[model samples]
Target chain A: MKPIEARTERGRRAPPLPSPGVRFGEGFLDRLGRLALRVRSRRERREGGGEARLLGGGMEFVGFRPYRPGEDLRRLDWNLFARHRRPFVRVSRRESSERWSVLLDRSASMGTGFPGKLQLAAEVVLGLKAAANIEGAEVDLHLMVRGEPHRHRGRGAALAEWMELLESTEARGRGGLARLLAEPGRFKDARALFLVGDLADLQPADIPRLTRSGRDILLVQVLAPEERDPTRLPEATHGDAVRWADPESTGVRTVRLDAHALAEYERGLGARLEAWRAIAAHHRVSFTTVTSDTPFEAVVERVFAR
Target chain B: MSVPQVAAALALGIEWSRPSGLLLLGPAALLLLLARRSARPVERVTATFDLWEDAMRRIPPAPRTRRLPPLPVVFAAVAITCAALALAGPRIVGSDPPRVFTILCDRSPSTSLPLQPGRTRFEVALEACLSELARRAGSTDRVRWRSQDRETLELPVGVKPPASWFARPAAFLPEIEWEREDRPGFLWVTDRVPTPSPSHALVFASGGRGVPGPVASRGGERVVWREGGLRVEPAPGRVVELRGVEAGRLGPLARLLTIWARERGFELRGGQERERALLIEAGRGAGETRELRIAGGSLGWGLAGTGGAGGIAELPEGAQVWRFGEASGGEAPILVAGSPGRVLLAFDGVRSVEGDPALFALAWSRFLDRWVLPAPGVVPLDERRDAGAASWDEWSEDRFEEVPRVGAGRGETTSADLLAPALAGIGVLFATLAILLSGGGISWLRGRLPASRTRT
Candidate 1:
């Protein structure tokens, strides 16, 4: 038989494209607008073993009481020490960190839950950008894409432009944070760094690479609730067969979601988080892991512990 | 009724006291349907299965459930049915095999003697026989009573006996037929146990006690004594002769005697009389008008207490004195026994007796029982004065043995009403099964059972 000619209506439109906006209420943006940033860091000396002070240097001079043992000798007010027998330093800066860095993981795993991890990552980015503006720091935006990362340095990209870029961006390929960081000539050092991702394919040794001795590094690990506890998801049943499809790869697994299975998952997830916490502490990096359902303000507070 | 007709009606029969209670089944059926519908298949989808993979490696898969629930619905239905049936009050409707009762009662003069103050020995025996009959009696049973004064009374089991069946004891008991004995249900009730204990008849003796007093009807209508028994109805055989004066001239005495004669069921022929059994005179005897003292034993013979005859009269030769005048001691008589073959009550007005109808009746009763009847009269002797409260065993004969009664045994046809509790137990059993099937109690049972036995 001859191939049938097109008899269907050409006017039938293709399925409409999805909107590119984060799944959050306007109340979150309002809370984000009211926030201000204050970063504290221990500045390590490159030439010596002992750490040096960065808190005493800034644009304006402030009053001081006494000099610390490990502080730089140049920060001491010599005139005040001559008038009084006490040795006092001039504390002029709120924080020495002038530049902030934000690196977002745009991997397929972030796209895998209701109120997706990617959306939370986007909200977390907005929160950091606002804080950096309040602290008058030049922020650099790095997108860990499938083939290569996109870097936006200093204040060259506007706030509107960053949001537009984040909204338009789709999580496509497997680009874990540790593997991206190990690549040569790709990233640069900054006074503070904000890493937003689910920490997939990460190892304990990679935590030091994200930090310099004087760096104020905060790792905001965003996750879908189901990654930590499957019972937290609506799709889970006490004893039902489930089909799971991995977003990045063609791997599919069939599972019976029973109480035993849920218990095993919880135990593994807990141990994983604890390992990450230990490694982060060793590197003196601020670390926080939160689900997509958590408030942005709460996550920031946990990361800085303020 | 035949064995075949009984067999047809008896197979697995049930009758409900409240058939309306079965209406509960409608709602119960609906409930079963609803339970079945609730068993819809459960399906869900989740994000990941990594931990599930680990758990699955250690534990077995969940058991497959059917789209519809069978265990719960079946249990519920059965429980409802049992409850409804229990409420309905089931009773067995099967017929019993035919039974027979052949009862015989003693008609001796002593049988009329009172065992207690109210009932005679014969009455006590009759009551016992009736009770036994009623206990085991069914529609198919047959009963025959060779009663005291009748040939054979066809007593309907489980019903009231006819009034005609209750006949009085004879003055002289005839030779009874106890040799042609009946089978298992044969019963013979008597005042005294007979000699050579019956080979087949179940003999029950009342143990005769007390001198015979006034005999009452089963309904307690008391009557005067007549010879061997109180209220004994004799055959109409007496001829009353009027001598020396016409019955018309005797006036009230003649009329009063006529009424008394009718009341006693005796047809007394007067006026143109033939050779008679009794004689009455208006004119003289030997004594003048004087009250006579009664004999010592006169009271026992049912005379008016303390006093004697109120009038004087002549008595026959070889007279046994019952009453005496003032001068005569116990030797002279106002009343006496007549000749051996023929008897008379010489009721002459010259005896000067007071006009007391009840006394006349008492005197007449004594005269009739002692002189008129064929058998010896039962005098209210002092030997039996307090026999009312004494044990009946006091009068048992040497051969008498009291037989223990197994009430309503063997061929009794009554159906039991124990089905209610059994139905309730069945309901509880169904409820237990339901609980097991639902797995509500499975955790408690888990320790006792193996891992493989658990459903999920």
Candidate 2:
């Protein structure tokens, strides 16, 4: 076969090149946007820790006041009694040395794929540890997994270590909140405690016990979309029989999930959420529900912004 | 005339015989005698004038064409001829009458009448049929008996030794072993003659149930009821009852019963044991079209509450939405784009969710669609015959008739008797019209003044 030579017509012209000015690029705003996040993180550190001021003072005796009825007797200031007629507890510039404890639920229900409840809980714990560590308060992180509770001291780089552990964790079994309550010394010396879980298998006692020590307790409930509504199921080729196995008890129940039953399920799940809300309210512990469908960044922004 | 004589005369094609024609001619002669006695003539005068000088003045008259009145005698003669012809009752075609003797006996349990002097209903019917052949049959004629199983069999015409016979519980089927050089006339014998066609004369003997088939034509050309030994029922009754006779033939009877049941659109299958589960991929809206593919059942497309097009069993447990159309892919749950009239969901083993207030709220969400059933609780039939909603006119042209028999082959007459009567009737009407028209013309001619009269 002979090769054919290609030639352009005399009157034809080449297409003009694209203008450089009109070209799209990662612009200055994009670079500055990165710098802006760094500034925000630095500002967050400055305003975030309530303990920084308390830890900044170098041994100045500030003042004293009479200890309240619920105050720990170990905190009665003997030096303040010499100056005042009544026995008093020391009130110093180094605001009371409060210990921080973070309790996380590691139940199987929290292991949903996106905006994971476990991951959200870990992030909240990290924030609390950063606040406590900068303020000279001791921090402890505890995981309410199916087995025994795992505790880690919130020290230098411990938050990252804890995050790495959480990242590597796999969801298995159930009975999270119950197991956490059963373990002794898990919430030791905690001035304030944060409990994070979907509270699927949680009992009424689980909430009250954490706040019973008079510490300011916050219960952050994390749930997946299925946990919240559970009526939404994907299309399937199989038949009507679906087996729901209880992660902890290994109990299985087969049910027909038609449209009517799905509606009923949603209604009941709503009632359960409301009941949880009411229980937390009565105990005076702050309660909030976090959905797994929300991005983790949005959740962090909302919680930290408040 | 005696019955056989009358049958023979019919076979000979003498419909009116000689006596009937004479009877018609007698009336014609009486009418002729009356017309001759009533005739009378009245005279009229006419004046003639002579043309001469004064005495002969001419009277000029206008020429008038005188028409002659029709002669009634001619009409009388024609009427007489026609009356004789009508009395003669001529058959236009020649056909040899059938010599076949078809005895149809009812072997049903209802036919087990103890009044007959035989061992069984089949035996009684057979004996009666055989005896009829012995009494009235010609030397070359044969005897056909309605077997207990409702089929026909022929017997030897002459005095012969008893042949070996076998009996099934339902009926008897006789097979002849020896072939004689002279074959007797053909015989169609059956118990409860399934039907009486134009071809066979049905001698229905059993008083129990009538024949189980369509009414057969009865005429000299088609059929003649065998008169003396066995009685024949004219028509097959509406309902047919079949009862299994006794212990010996129940197995074969059961098979026959099964065949009948299948004919009535009942199907029997082995029991199914496995339980099935459903996997439904529903879209966002309840009203959105869904494609449901059932594991064991049909794959169909439909709305939630409405019944679907396929053979899918009702939606399975744990299915939030029933799918229809084709299966879909890509992460977002199949978004039912439209709102349906109604939606139903089944929770997979999550009993606690039944009472969940949240699930109900989500189900009623405006974003979701609802599906309405055109008719609720109506289960459609799988087969076309059982589909009660279908109109008769909608039935398939194919297979509408149960047993399609081969019609008359080329050059053969399917029904000469039927066509012959219709053609003869048409010819008679035309002849009547011609006679009336000719009679009218003759009457007009008779009313006119005749130029000359020739007849006496």
Per-residue alpha-carbon lDDT of model 1 for A41-137, expressed as tens digits? 2111211222223243553454565775755577678998899977777655334347677888877667755577778888778777765665456
Highest DockQ scorer: 1
Docking class of 2: incorrect
Report the C-alpha lDDT of model 1 over B334-379, residue by residue, as the tens digit. 5434432223332343222344556655665555534333322333
Question: Stretches of candidate 1 above 4 Å error?
Answer: A1-28, A37-97, A234-237, B1-456
By how many angstroms RMSD does model 2 differ from the true structure?
Answer: 54.1
Candidate 2 per-residue lDDT, tens place, B219-337, comes to 11112223222333443111112221221222332243234324422221223212101111222223323333222112211222211223233433222343333344543233222
Reference-based lDDT, each prediction: 0.56, 0.40
State each model's TM-score restricted to chain B.
0.34, 0.27
Q: Pick the candidate with the highest lDDT.
A: 1
Give interface RMSD for all predictions.
14.2, 65.9
Candidate 1 clashing pairs, residues 3+ apart or interchain = B227-B369, B310-B352, B310-B353, B311-B351, B311-B352, B311-B353, B312-B351
List each candidate's DockQ score.
0.08, 0.00
